[model samples]
Target: AGGRVLLVEDEMSILKFTARMFQKHGFQVHTTAMNGLEGLEMMNRNIYVAVFTDINMPVMDGFECVRRFRDWENESEERRSLRGGRQFVCAVTANAGPQGDRDRALRTGLMDAFVAKPAKIMDLVAMARRSAEDTLGHSNGN
Candidate 1:
């Protein structure tokens, strides 16, 4: 994944591991606290190709972060929405036990996908890479 990634996670251990993995795979990664407010500030300051955030967080949660991101995109005055900078925001969490959890996440209008934790799915990085590629293609008129 040569593209840049914005990672929002509350757990220090998980955040470190995930950031290391992305770095090892050639991704330019930026991380933020689990707080939604902080994450939103970061998003507003920088342009990233994808965003991987945990569903559960302190201060501000993943759902709210996604909502803010979506709302900003929708309300931006730019005529070409894609040029506004697209991100594939996904949930990396252990809370897939309930169907409503996933449903609510989808309804938030920010996430592009979900992945369960203890993170058995090692291929998630690959999926994220592909998602980045797809986002770029869509934005660039491929």
Candidate 2:
């Protein structure tokens, strides 16, 4: 089995499809949340190797969720220990407008990477692999 992963997406179809993809790729555990607030709660309770979040949604947005996660990670040693280290966060959004939203999201210093909507399966698989490797490396003090 591969690493555990979390997918925070408002769109139900996308969420289902993506989760299936991750499971097909050998991930042992894949969880989904409809919005950022729910995602944050899940994150606090479970240790995921990577988190894939949408940029825009009702209630809490991805930016706020990432920000809150970073805060929790920095402030709580227990939370950090639960994760074994920092977990990779990837922004998955359909918003590729002229404003460079992806760049802005990355600049927030919360996201480790970005993937536009209609993402390639190979890219998603690679992202999970990379995140798992990163988590392993960090845990090993590399």
**Candidate 2: stretches off by over 4 Å:** 81-84
User: TM-scores, in order shown?
Assistant: 0.85, 0.90
- lDDT for 63 in candidate 1 is 87
Q: Which predicted model would earn the best TM-score?
A: 2
* Residue-wise C-alpha lDDT for candidate 2, range 1-142, written one tens digit per residue: 6688899989998888888888998985455589999999888778887889998988999999989988998888876764465768889888866676598886778888888887886797798898788777767777
Worst 10 residues of 2 by lDDT: 78-87
lDDT of 1 by residue, 94-116 (tens): 88776755777766656788777
Clashes of each: 1, 0
TM-score of 1: 0.85
Colliding residue pairs in candidate 2: none
Candidate 2 residue-wise lDDT at 61: 94
Off by over 4 Å in 1: 83-85
